[model samples]
Target: MTRDATSFDALYKAEPDPWNYETSAYEAEKYRRCLALLPRCRYPRGLEIGCSIGVMSAEIAQRCDSLLALDFAQTAVARARARGIPNARFEVATIPAEWPAGRWDLIVLSEVLYYLGPAELDRTVTLVAKSLAAGGCCLVAGYTGPTETTLSALDVQDRLLHGLAEAHPRHAIYKDRDASWIAAIFECRTCPAGG
Candidate 1:
Protein backbone atom coordinates (compact mmCIF):
# COMPACT_ATOMS: atom_id res chain seq x y z
CA MET A 1 0.00 0.00 0.00
CA THR A 2 1.07 3.58 -0.55
CA ARG A 3 1.89 5.56 2.55
CA ASP A 4 -1.27 7.00 4.01
CA ALA A 5 -2.21 10.63 3.43
CA THR A 6 -2.56 11.08 7.18
CA SER A 7 1.16 10.58 7.74
CA PHE A 8 1.93 13.17 5.06
CA ASP A 9 -0.69 15.44 6.56
CA ALA A 10 0.95 15.09 9.94
CA LEU A 11 4.34 15.77 8.39
CA TYR A 12 3.16 19.04 6.85
CA LYS A 13 1.42 19.99 10.05
CA ALA A 14 4.63 19.52 12.01
CA GLU A 15 6.76 21.33 9.44
CA PRO A 16 5.71 22.91 6.21
CA ASP A 17 8.92 22.28 4.31
CA PRO A 18 9.54 18.80 5.70
CA TRP A 19 12.10 17.90 3.03
CA ASN A 20 13.94 21.23 2.92
CA TYR A 21 13.03 21.37 -0.75
CA GLU A 22 12.78 25.16 -0.59
CA THR A 23 16.43 25.70 0.33
CA SER A 24 18.29 22.57 -0.68
CA ALA A 25 21.01 22.91 -3.30
CA TYR A 26 20.85 19.18 -3.88
CA GLU A 27 17.22 19.44 -4.87
CA ALA A 28 17.96 22.41 -7.13
CA GLU A 29 20.63 20.37 -8.92
CA LYS A 30 18.29 17.40 -9.32
CA TYR A 31 15.64 19.64 -10.83
CA ARG A 32 18.21 20.94 -13.30
CA ARG A 33 19.16 17.40 -14.29
CA CYS A 34 15.52 16.42 -14.67
CA LEU A 35 14.80 19.36 -16.95
CA ALA A 36 17.85 18.52 -19.05
CA LEU A 37 16.79 14.89 -19.46
CA LEU A 38 13.42 15.61 -21.00
CA PRO A 39 13.54 14.77 -24.75
CA ARG A 40 11.37 17.65 -25.87
CA CYS A 41 11.94 21.27 -25.18
CA ARG A 42 8.23 21.87 -24.81
CA TYR A 43 5.51 19.43 -23.79
CA PRO A 44 1.88 20.14 -24.67
CA ARG A 45 0.64 18.32 -21.57
CA GLY A 46 2.41 17.35 -18.38
CA LEU A 47 1.72 15.95 -14.91
CA GLU A 48 3.91 16.23 -11.84
CA ILE A 49 3.21 13.86 -8.93
CA GLY A 50 4.32 14.74 -5.44
CA CYS A 51 5.11 18.26 -6.47
CA SER A 52 6.00 19.55 -3.05
CA ILE A 53 5.84 23.34 -2.86
CA GLY A 54 5.97 23.69 -6.66
CA VAL A 55 9.53 24.94 -6.75
CA MET A 56 10.37 22.50 -9.51
CA SER A 57 6.87 22.76 -10.89
CA ALA A 58 7.41 26.45 -11.53
CA GLU A 59 10.35 25.63 -13.75
CA ILE A 60 8.49 22.71 -15.33
CA ALA A 61 5.51 24.93 -15.99
CA GLN A 62 7.64 27.05 -18.30
CA ARG A 63 8.29 23.96 -20.43
CA CYS A 64 4.70 22.75 -20.54
CA ASP A 65 1.66 24.30 -22.13
CA SER A 66 -0.62 22.74 -19.51
CA LEU A 67 0.60 21.12 -16.30
CA LEU A 68 -1.18 19.36 -13.47
CA ALA A 69 0.72 19.10 -10.20
CA LEU A 70 -0.58 16.78 -7.46
CA ASP A 71 0.33 15.97 -3.88
CA PHE A 72 -1.48 14.03 -1.15
CA ALA A 73 -0.88 16.80 1.36
CA GLN A 74 -3.18 19.78 1.14
CA THR A 75 -0.60 22.08 2.66
CA ALA A 76 1.81 21.21 -0.10
CA VAL A 77 -0.86 21.79 -2.70
CA ALA A 78 -1.70 25.21 -1.27
CA ARG A 79 1.93 26.20 -1.18
CA ALA A 80 2.40 25.00 -4.75
CA ARG A 81 -0.52 27.09 -5.86
CA ALA A 82 1.03 30.12 -4.28
CA ARG A 83 3.91 29.85 -6.76
CA GLY A 84 1.40 31.47 -9.16
CA ILE A 85 2.36 29.69 -12.33
CA PRO A 86 -0.51 30.51 -14.65
CA ASN A 87 -0.15 27.42 -16.83
CA ALA A 88 0.01 24.96 -13.94
CA ARG A 89 -2.79 23.50 -11.82
CA PHE A 90 -2.17 22.28 -8.28
CA GLU A 91 -4.38 19.73 -6.53
CA VAL A 92 -4.42 17.31 -3.59
CA ALA A 93 -4.48 13.77 -4.88
CA THR A 94 -2.99 10.41 -3.89
CA ILE A 95 -1.34 8.23 -6.49
CA PRO A 96 -2.78 4.99 -7.93
CA ALA A 97 -6.08 6.09 -6.39
CA GLU A 98 -6.67 9.72 -7.24
CA TRP A 99 -5.06 9.60 -10.65
CA PRO A 100 -5.69 12.30 -13.25
CA ALA A 101 -8.25 11.91 -16.00
CA GLY A 102 -6.14 12.07 -19.17
CA ARG A 103 -2.92 10.95 -20.78
CA TRP A 104 0.15 13.19 -20.78
CA ASP A 105 3.12 13.98 -22.97
CA LEU A 106 5.36 14.32 -19.95
CA ILE A 107 4.74 12.73 -16.54
CA VAL A 108 7.04 13.51 -13.61
CA LEU A 109 7.50 11.14 -10.66
CA SER A 110 10.04 12.91 -8.49
CA GLU A 111 11.16 11.89 -5.05
CA VAL A 112 7.75 10.39 -4.43
CA LEU A 113 7.55 6.73 -5.47
CA TYR A 114 9.82 5.46 -2.71
CA TYR A 115 7.01 6.20 -0.29
CA LEU A 116 4.86 3.44 -1.78
CA GLY A 117 5.10 -0.23 -0.91
CA PRO A 118 5.92 -2.90 -3.51
CA ALA A 119 2.32 -3.51 -4.51
CA GLU A 120 1.48 0.18 -4.76
CA LEU A 121 4.69 0.88 -6.60
CA ASP A 122 3.91 -1.80 -9.19
CA ARG A 123 0.36 -0.64 -9.62
CA THR A 124 1.41 2.99 -9.91
CA VAL A 125 4.05 2.15 -12.49
CA THR A 126 1.51 0.22 -14.49
CA LEU A 127 -0.88 3.14 -14.32
CA VAL A 128 1.89 5.48 -15.43
CA ALA A 129 2.59 3.34 -18.48
CA LYS A 130 -1.10 3.20 -19.36
CA SER A 131 -1.41 6.97 -19.01
CA LEU A 132 1.44 7.99 -21.30
CA ALA A 133 0.34 9.49 -24.57
CA ALA A 134 1.65 8.28 -27.92
CA GLY A 135 5.36 9.00 -28.08
CA GLY A 136 5.17 10.54 -24.61
CA CYS A 137 7.61 10.03 -21.75
CA CYS A 138 7.62 9.55 -17.98
CA LEU A 139 10.41 10.88 -15.77
CA VAL A 140 11.05 9.01 -12.49
CA ALA A 141 13.57 10.45 -10.02
CA GLY A 142 14.42 9.55 -6.44
CA TYR A 143 17.29 9.61 -3.98
CA THR A 144 19.08 6.71 -2.29
CA GLY A 145 18.46 7.79 1.27
CA PRO A 146 17.39 6.10 4.48
CA THR A 147 13.63 6.31 4.69
CA GLU A 148 10.84 5.07 6.96
CA THR A 149 8.80 4.06 3.92
CA THR A 150 8.48 0.48 2.63
CA LEU A 151 10.18 0.95 -0.78
CA SER A 152 13.65 2.11 -1.60
CA ALA A 153 14.80 4.09 -4.65
CA LEU A 154 16.16 0.95 -6.25
CA ASP A 155 12.94 -0.92 -5.54
CA VAL A 156 10.84 1.75 -7.18
CA GLN A 157 13.14 1.96 -10.21
CA ASP A 158 13.10 -1.80 -10.59
CA ARG A 159 9.32 -1.85 -10.52
CA LEU A 160 9.23 0.91 -13.15
CA LEU A 161 11.58 -1.02 -15.40
CA HIS A 162 9.62 -4.27 -15.09
CA GLY A 163 6.13 -2.77 -15.13
CA LEU A 164 6.51 -0.34 -18.04
CA ALA A 165 7.37 -2.93 -20.65
CA GLU A 166 7.55 -2.10 -24.40
CA ALA A 167 9.08 1.29 -23.78
CA HIS A 168 12.51 2.66 -24.64
CA PRO A 169 13.82 3.49 -21.21
CA ARG A 170 16.77 5.76 -20.56
CA HIS A 171 18.54 5.78 -17.25
CA ALA A 172 20.37 8.92 -16.09
CA ILE A 173 22.34 8.00 -13.01
CA TYR A 174 23.35 11.22 -11.21
CA LYS A 175 26.36 10.20 -9.16
CA ASP A 176 28.17 13.50 -9.55
CA ARG A 177 31.37 12.92 -7.56
CA ASP A 178 29.40 11.61 -4.54
CA ALA A 179 25.76 12.52 -5.10
CA SER A 180 23.13 9.76 -4.69
CA TRP A 181 20.14 10.26 -6.93
CA ILE A 182 18.75 8.34 -9.95
CA ALA A 183 16.53 9.80 -12.65
CA ALA A 184 15.13 7.66 -15.46
CA ILE A 185 12.98 8.47 -18.46
CA PHE A 186 10.79 5.99 -20.32
CA GLU A 187 9.58 6.96 -23.78
CA CYS A 188 6.63 5.12 -25.26
CA ARG A 189 7.07 3.16 -28.52
CA THR A 190 4.46 5.01 -30.51
CA CYS A 191 5.79 4.47 -33.98
CA PRO A 192 6.05 1.28 -36.05
CA ALA A 193 9.32 -0.07 -37.39
CA GLY A 194 11.01 2.27 -39.89
CA GLY A 195 7.83 4.18 -40.47
Candidate 2:
Protein backbone atom coordinates (compact mmCIF):
# COMPACT_ATOMS: atom_id res chain seq x y z
CA MET A 1 0.00 0.00 0.00
CA THR A 2 1.04 3.61 -0.52
CA ARG A 3 2.34 5.43 2.53
CA ASP A 4 -0.42 7.69 3.80
CA ALA A 5 -0.27 11.44 4.42
CA THR A 6 -0.96 11.10 8.13
CA SER A 7 2.23 9.16 8.67
CA PHE A 8 4.21 11.80 6.85
CA ASP A 9 2.44 14.56 8.75
CA ALA A 10 3.23 12.91 12.04
CA LEU A 11 6.82 12.49 11.00
CA TYR A 12 7.17 16.17 10.14
CA LYS A 13 5.44 17.17 13.35
CA ALA A 14 7.90 15.10 15.32
CA GLU A 15 10.98 16.30 13.43
CA PRO A 16 11.12 19.28 11.13
CA ASP A 17 13.97 17.80 9.12
CA PRO A 18 13.17 14.12 9.29
CA TRP A 19 15.44 13.37 6.37
CA ASN A 20 18.20 15.74 7.46
CA TYR A 21 17.89 17.46 4.11
CA GLU A 22 19.77 20.53 5.23
CA THR A 23 22.82 19.16 6.98
CA SER A 24 23.54 15.77 5.52
CA ALA A 25 26.61 15.65 3.33
CA TYR A 26 25.15 12.69 1.47
CA GLU A 27 21.96 14.54 0.62
CA ALA A 28 23.97 17.60 -0.38
CA GLU A 29 25.94 15.48 -2.82
CA LYS A 30 22.79 13.79 -4.06
CA TYR A 31 21.20 17.17 -4.75
CA ARG A 32 24.30 18.35 -6.57
CA ARG A 33 24.42 15.23 -8.73
CA CYS A 34 20.71 15.35 -9.44
CA LEU A 35 20.89 18.98 -10.46
CA ALA A 36 23.86 18.24 -12.67
CA LEU A 37 21.85 15.53 -14.43
CA LEU A 38 19.22 17.96 -15.71
CA PRO A 39 19.46 18.26 -19.50
CA ARG A 40 19.00 22.00 -19.69
CA CYS A 41 20.51 24.86 -17.71
CA ARG A 42 17.17 26.54 -17.25
CA TYR A 43 13.46 25.68 -17.28
CA PRO A 44 10.63 28.13 -17.65
CA ARG A 45 8.25 26.12 -15.49
CA GLY A 46 9.15 23.41 -13.02
CA LEU A 47 7.36 21.09 -10.61
CA GLU A 48 8.91 19.23 -7.73
CA ILE A 49 7.04 16.37 -6.10
CA GLY A 50 7.56 15.58 -2.40
CA CYS A 51 9.59 18.65 -1.66
CA SER A 52 9.67 18.08 2.10
CA ILE A 53 11.12 21.37 3.30
CA GLY A 54 12.30 23.04 0.08
CA VAL A 55 15.95 22.12 0.43
CA MET A 56 16.05 20.67 -3.04
CA SER A 57 13.38 23.10 -4.16
CA ALA A 58 15.72 25.97 -3.34
CA GLU A 59 18.32 24.45 -5.62
CA ILE A 60 15.80 23.64 -8.32
CA ALA A 61 14.32 27.13 -8.21
CA GLN A 62 17.67 28.60 -9.17
CA ARG A 63 17.34 26.88 -12.54
CA CYS A 64 13.65 27.56 -13.13
CA ASP A 65 11.77 30.72 -13.92
CA SER A 66 8.93 29.49 -11.71
CA LEU A 67 8.69 26.39 -9.56
CA LEU A 68 5.80 24.73 -7.79
CA ALA A 69 6.83 22.35 -5.04
CA LEU A 70 4.44 19.90 -3.42
CA ASP A 71 4.45 17.79 -0.26
CA PHE A 72 1.76 15.56 1.16
CA ALA A 73 2.26 16.83 4.72
CA GLN A 74 1.01 20.26 5.55
CA THR A 75 3.66 20.73 8.18
CA ALA A 76 6.31 20.02 5.62
CA VAL A 77 4.70 22.43 3.20
CA ALA A 78 4.70 25.11 5.88
CA ARG A 79 8.37 24.60 6.46
CA ALA A 80 9.06 24.67 2.76
CA ARG A 81 7.13 27.89 2.38
CA ALA A 82 9.14 29.41 5.20
CA ARG A 83 12.25 29.02 3.13
CA GLY A 84 11.20 32.15 1.22
CA ILE A 85 12.37 31.01 -2.17
CA PRO A 86 11.26 33.90 -4.38
CA ASN A 87 10.52 31.84 -7.47
CA ALA A 88 9.13 28.76 -5.74
CA ARG A 89 5.70 28.03 -4.29
CA PHE A 90 5.09 25.28 -1.77
CA GLU A 91 1.76 23.51 -1.38
CA VAL A 92 0.28 20.56 0.42
CA ALA A 93 -0.78 17.89 -2.06
CA THR A 94 -1.10 14.15 -2.42
CA ILE A 95 0.23 12.70 -5.64
CA PRO A 96 -1.77 10.71 -8.19
CA ALA A 97 -4.81 12.55 -6.79
CA GLU A 98 -4.23 16.28 -6.53
CA TRP A 99 -1.67 17.23 -9.16
CA PRO A 100 -1.72 20.81 -10.42
CA ALA A 101 -3.03 21.63 -13.89
CA GLY A 102 -0.75 22.49 -16.90
CA ARG A 103 2.36 21.24 -18.50
CA TRP A 104 5.81 21.69 -16.95
CA ASP A 105 9.23 22.15 -18.50
CA LEU A 106 10.86 20.25 -15.65
CA ILE A 107 9.42 17.71 -13.21
CA VAL A 108 11.38 16.32 -10.29
CA LEU A 109 10.71 13.17 -8.29
CA SER A 110 13.34 12.81 -5.62
CA GLU A 111 13.45 9.83 -3.30
CA VAL A 112 9.67 9.74 -3.17
CA LEU A 113 8.15 7.36 -5.75
CA TYR A 114 9.01 4.16 -3.92
CA TYR A 115 6.42 4.95 -1.27
CA LEU A 116 3.53 4.55 -3.72
CA GLY A 117 1.65 1.34 -4.29
CA PRO A 118 1.60 -0.21 -7.76
CA ALA A 119 -1.69 1.42 -8.84
CA GLU A 120 -0.75 4.86 -7.57
CA LEU A 121 2.68 4.58 -9.14
CA ASP A 122 1.15 3.76 -12.50
CA ARG A 123 -1.24 6.69 -12.27
CA THR A 124 1.63 9.03 -11.39
CA VAL A 125 3.61 7.87 -14.40
CA THR A 126 0.65 8.67 -16.64
CA LEU A 127 0.24 12.09 -15.06
CA VAL A 128 3.94 12.86 -15.49
CA ALA A 129 4.06 11.85 -19.14
CA LYS A 130 0.90 13.74 -20.02
CA SER A 131 1.82 16.88 -18.07
CA LEU A 132 5.36 17.15 -19.41
CA ALA A 133 5.73 19.76 -22.15
CA ALA A 134 6.86 18.61 -25.58
CA GLY A 135 10.46 19.54 -24.91
CA GLY A 136 10.40 19.14 -21.15
CA CYS A 137 12.32 16.76 -18.96
CA CYS A 138 11.62 14.57 -15.93
CA LEU A 139 14.28 13.91 -13.31
CA VAL A 140 13.88 10.92 -11.03
CA ALA A 141 16.12 10.32 -8.04
CA GLY A 142 15.73 7.29 -5.81
CA TYR A 143 17.46 5.71 -2.86
CA THR A 144 18.78 2.29 -3.74
CA GLY A 145 18.95 1.24 -0.10
CA PRO A 146 16.54 -1.30 1.39
CA THR A 147 13.11 0.02 2.30
CA GLU A 148 9.84 -1.02 3.88
CA THR A 149 7.78 0.91 1.36
CA THR A 150 5.53 -0.60 -1.33
CA LEU A 151 8.32 -0.65 -3.91
CA SER A 152 12.08 -0.60 -4.00
CA ALA A 153 13.83 2.32 -5.67
CA LEU A 154 14.97 0.19 -8.60
CA ASP A 155 11.51 -1.30 -8.90
CA VAL A 156 9.97 2.14 -9.02
CA GLN A 157 12.45 3.25 -11.66
CA ASP A 158 11.82 0.23 -13.83
CA ARG A 159 8.05 0.57 -13.58
CA LEU A 160 8.22 4.29 -14.25
CA LEU A 161 10.38 3.85 -17.35
CA HIS A 162 8.12 1.10 -18.67
CA GLY A 163 4.96 3.08 -18.03
CA LEU A 164 6.43 6.19 -19.63
CA ALA A 165 7.46 4.18 -22.66
CA GLU A 166 3.82 3.18 -23.15
CA ALA A 167 2.53 6.74 -22.68
CA HIS A 168 5.04 8.79 -24.72
CA PRO A 169 8.25 8.68 -26.65
CA ARG A 170 11.08 10.16 -24.57
CA HIS A 171 14.82 9.86 -24.56
CA ALA A 172 16.60 8.58 -21.49
CA ILE A 173 19.27 11.21 -21.69
CA TYR A 174 21.14 10.72 -18.44
CA LYS A 175 21.56 8.10 -15.71
CA ASP A 176 23.76 7.61 -12.66
CA ARG A 177 23.78 4.84 -10.08
CA ASP A 178 25.80 3.76 -7.10
CA ALA A 179 25.36 1.39 -4.19
CA SER A 180 23.17 3.89 -2.34
CA TRP A 181 21.05 5.67 -4.96
CA ILE A 182 20.08 6.13 -8.61
CA ALA A 183 19.12 9.14 -10.73
CA ALA A 184 17.96 9.58 -14.32
CA ILE A 185 16.65 12.20 -16.72
CA PHE A 186 14.11 11.61 -19.51
CA GLU A 187 13.54 14.26 -22.14
CA CYS A 188 10.72 14.59 -24.64
CA ARG A 189 11.77 14.67 -28.29
CA THR A 190 9.01 16.79 -29.76
CA CYS A 191 9.77 20.10 -28.11
CA PRO A 192 10.03 23.17 -30.35
CA ALA A 193 12.93 25.62 -30.18
CA GLY A 194 13.41 27.21 -26.74
CA GLY A 195 10.70 24.99 -25.28
Candidate 3:
Protein backbone atom coordinates (compact mmCIF):
# COMPACT_ATOMS: atom_id res chain seq x y z
CA MET A 1 0.00 0.00 0.00
CA THR A 2 1.16 3.53 -0.77
CA ARG A 3 2.10 5.80 2.10
CA ASP A 4 -0.40 8.52 1.70
CA ALA A 5 -1.25 11.45 3.99
CA THR A 6 -3.22 8.95 6.08
CA SER A 7 -0.05 7.03 6.91
CA PHE A 8 1.35 10.17 8.50
CA ASP A 9 -1.90 10.94 10.30
CA ALA A 10 -1.73 7.55 11.99
CA LEU A 11 1.95 8.01 12.67
CA TYR A 12 1.47 11.43 14.27
CA LYS A 13 -1.57 10.20 16.20
CA ALA A 14 0.70 7.76 18.00
CA GLU A 15 3.33 10.43 18.72
CA PRO A 16 3.18 14.16 18.22
CA ASP A 17 6.81 14.26 17.25
CA PRO A 18 7.65 10.89 15.75
CA TRP A 19 11.21 11.97 14.83
CA ASN A 20 12.28 13.31 18.24
CA TYR A 21 13.05 16.88 17.28
CA GLU A 22 14.56 18.06 20.59
CA THR A 23 16.95 15.17 21.15
CA SER A 24 17.70 13.71 17.72
CA ALA A 25 21.09 14.62 16.24
CA TYR A 26 19.96 13.54 12.79
CA GLU A 27 17.04 15.95 12.63
CA ALA A 28 19.14 18.85 13.87
CA GLU A 29 21.88 18.52 11.26
CA LYS A 30 19.39 17.86 8.51
CA TYR A 31 17.61 21.13 9.26
CA ARG A 32 20.92 22.94 9.36
CA ARG A 33 21.91 21.70 5.92
CA CYS A 34 18.49 22.46 4.49
CA LEU A 35 18.65 26.16 5.40
CA ALA A 36 22.25 26.75 4.30
CA LEU A 37 21.66 25.22 0.85
CA LEU A 38 18.61 27.29 0.00
CA PRO A 39 18.89 29.33 -3.23
CA ARG A 40 17.56 32.49 -1.64
CA CYS A 41 18.27 34.14 1.67
CA ARG A 42 14.76 35.40 2.17
CA TYR A 43 11.33 34.22 1.10
CA PRO A 44 7.98 35.92 1.63
CA ARG A 45 5.92 32.76 1.81
CA GLY A 46 7.20 29.24 2.49
CA LEU A 47 5.54 25.88 2.80
CA GLU A 48 6.68 22.94 4.89
CA ILE A 49 4.90 19.67 4.37
CA GLY A 50 4.76 17.00 7.03
CA CYS A 51 5.97 19.41 9.65
CA SER A 52 5.43 16.77 12.42
CA ILE A 53 5.75 18.68 15.73
CA GLY A 54 7.11 21.84 14.04
CA VAL A 55 10.78 21.56 14.95
CA MET A 56 11.83 21.99 11.34
CA SER A 57 9.23 24.66 10.97
CA ALA A 58 10.85 26.69 13.72
CA GLU A 59 14.14 26.50 11.89
CA ILE A 60 12.56 27.35 8.56
CA ALA A 61 10.82 30.28 10.16
CA GLN A 62 14.15 32.04 10.44
CA ARG A 63 14.43 32.33 6.65
CA CYS A 64 10.94 33.34 5.66
CA ASP A 65 8.57 36.14 6.58
CA SER A 66 5.73 33.65 6.93
CA LEU A 67 5.55 29.88 6.84
CA LEU A 68 2.65 27.52 6.38
CA ALA A 69 3.50 24.34 8.25
CA LEU A 70 1.26 21.41 7.58
CA ASP A 71 0.74 17.99 9.14
CA PHE A 72 -1.96 15.40 8.60
CA ALA A 73 -2.83 14.79 12.22
CA GLN A 74 -4.74 17.14 14.47
CA THR A 75 -2.62 16.04 17.42
CA ALA A 76 0.52 17.21 15.68
CA VAL A 77 -1.20 20.39 14.58
CA ALA A 78 -2.27 21.25 18.08
CA ARG A 79 1.23 20.87 19.47
CA ALA A 80 2.79 22.56 16.45
CA ARG A 81 0.51 25.52 16.82
CA ALA A 82 1.10 25.63 20.54
CA ARG A 83 4.87 25.58 20.09
CA GLY A 84 4.61 29.35 19.46
CA ILE A 85 7.06 28.92 16.65
CA PRO A 86 7.94 32.31 15.19
CA ASN A 87 6.50 33.52 11.90
CA ALA A 88 4.57 30.28 11.52
CA ARG A 89 0.93 29.47 10.89
CA PHE A 90 0.12 25.86 11.64
CA GLU A 91 -2.61 23.88 9.94
CA VAL A 92 -3.81 20.28 9.87
CA ALA A 93 -4.04 19.20 6.29
CA THR A 94 -3.27 16.24 4.02
CA ILE A 95 -0.81 16.35 1.19
CA PRO A 96 -1.99 16.96 -2.39
CA ALA A 97 -5.48 17.20 -0.94
CA GLU A 98 -4.90 20.38 1.06
CA TRP A 99 -2.13 22.16 -0.79
CA PRO A 100 -2.57 25.93 -0.99
CA ALA A 101 -3.33 27.50 -4.34
CA GLY A 102 -1.05 29.90 -6.28
CA ARG A 103 2.73 29.70 -5.81
CA TRP A 104 5.37 29.59 -3.10
CA ASP A 105 8.89 30.97 -2.92
CA LEU A 106 10.15 28.00 -0.95
CA ILE A 107 8.88 24.48 -0.24
CA VAL A 108 10.44 21.95 2.07
CA LEU A 109 9.72 18.23 1.71
CA SER A 110 12.18 17.18 4.32
CA GLU A 111 12.02 13.48 5.21
CA VAL A 112 8.43 13.12 4.12
CA LEU A 113 8.64 11.57 0.63
CA TYR A 114 9.40 7.98 1.57
CA TYR A 115 5.98 7.35 3.03
CA LEU A 116 4.54 7.93 -0.45
CA GLY A 117 4.69 5.44 -3.33
CA PRO A 118 5.87 6.24 -6.87
CA ALA A 119 2.64 7.50 -8.38
CA GLU A 120 1.76 9.80 -5.53
CA LEU A 121 5.34 11.01 -5.31
CA ASP A 122 5.33 11.78 -9.01
CA ARG A 123 2.14 13.74 -8.60
CA THR A 124 3.84 15.60 -5.77
CA VAL A 125 6.84 16.43 -7.94
CA THR A 126 4.53 17.70 -10.61
CA LEU A 127 2.83 19.84 -8.03
CA VAL A 128 6.16 21.11 -6.74
CA ALA A 129 7.31 22.00 -10.23
CA LYS A 130 4.11 23.86 -10.98
CA SER A 131 3.63 25.47 -7.59
CA LEU A 132 7.06 27.06 -7.51
CA ALA A 133 7.16 30.79 -8.27
CA ALA A 134 9.60 32.15 -10.78
CA GLY A 135 13.10 31.85 -9.31
CA GLY A 136 11.67 29.90 -6.38
CA CYS A 137 13.25 26.65 -5.16
CA CYS A 138 11.99 23.50 -3.50
CA LEU A 139 14.26 21.53 -1.16
CA VAL A 140 13.59 17.77 -1.21
CA ALA A 141 15.47 15.54 1.22
CA GLY A 142 14.66 12.38 3.17
CA TYR A 143 16.26 9.87 5.50
CA THR A 144 18.93 8.66 3.05
CA GLY A 145 18.30 4.92 3.45
CA PRO A 146 15.92 2.48 5.05
CA THR A 147 15.37 2.29 8.78
CA GLU A 148 13.91 -0.40 11.03
CA THR A 149 10.64 1.45 10.82
CA THR A 150 8.40 2.25 7.81
CA LEU A 151 10.69 5.09 6.67
CA SER A 152 12.32 4.77 3.22
CA ALA A 153 15.34 6.78 2.20
CA LEU A 154 14.70 9.51 -0.33
CA ASP A 155 18.14 8.69 -1.78
CA VAL A 156 17.35 5.10 -2.76
CA GLN A 157 13.79 5.60 -3.84
CA ASP A 158 13.02 5.92 -7.56
CA ARG A 159 9.49 6.82 -6.60
CA LEU A 160 10.43 10.50 -6.68
CA LEU A 161 10.71 11.73 -10.28
CA HIS A 162 13.79 13.92 -9.95
CA GLY A 163 17.16 12.16 -10.13
CA LEU A 164 19.38 12.66 -7.08
CA ALA A 165 21.76 15.03 -8.84
CA GLU A 166 22.77 18.50 -7.71
CA ALA A 167 23.21 19.72 -11.28
CA HIS A 168 21.00 18.02 -13.83
CA PRO A 169 20.88 19.40 -17.37
CA ARG A 170 17.75 21.20 -16.18
CA HIS A 171 18.62 21.58 -12.46
CA ALA A 172 21.13 20.53 -9.79
CA ILE A 173 21.58 18.13 -6.85
CA TYR A 174 24.16 18.18 -4.07
CA LYS A 175 24.48 15.29 -1.63
CA ASP A 176 25.95 16.21 1.74
CA ARG A 177 27.26 13.40 3.90
CA ASP A 178 26.47 13.91 7.56
CA ALA A 179 27.31 11.78 10.58
CA SER A 180 23.93 10.08 10.42
CA TRP A 181 22.85 10.25 6.73
CA ILE A 182 23.25 12.08 3.42
CA ALA A 183 21.16 15.14 2.50
CA ALA A 184 20.37 15.72 -1.17
CA ILE A 185 19.48 19.08 -2.77
CA PHE A 186 17.33 19.33 -5.89
CA GLU A 187 16.81 22.72 -7.59
CA CYS A 188 14.03 23.53 -10.01
CA ARG A 189 14.26 24.11 -13.76
CA THR A 190 15.32 27.61 -14.80
CA CYS A 191 13.73 29.30 -17.74
CA PRO A 192 15.52 30.64 -20.82
CA ALA A 193 16.03 34.30 -19.95
CA GLY A 194 16.28 33.81 -16.16
CA GLY A 195 14.56 32.03 -13.33
| Highest TM-score model number | 2
lDDT agreement with native, every candidate: 0.80, 0.89, 0.71
lDDT of 3 by residue, 116-145 (tens): 655656667667667776556677676655
Count of clashing pairs, candidate 2: 0
Residue 183's lDDT within candidate 3 is 56
Global CA lDDT of candidate 1, please?
A: 0.80
lDDT of 2 by residue, 1-195 (tens): 566899889999999998899999999999999899887899999999999989999999999999999999999999999999999999889998998999999999999999888888989998998898888888888998767786888888888777766666656568887679999888877857576
RMSD (CA, angstroms), candidate 3: 3.5
Model 1: lDDT of residue 49 = 93
lDDT of 1 by residue, 52-131 (tens): 88899998898999999999988888889988899999999988788898888889988899887677777788788778
Give each prediction's root-mean-square deviation over alpha carbons: 3.1, 1.6, 3.5
Indicate the worst ten consecutive residues by lDDT in candidate 1. 169-178
Off by over 4 Å in 3: 1-14, 148-151, 155-170, 189-195
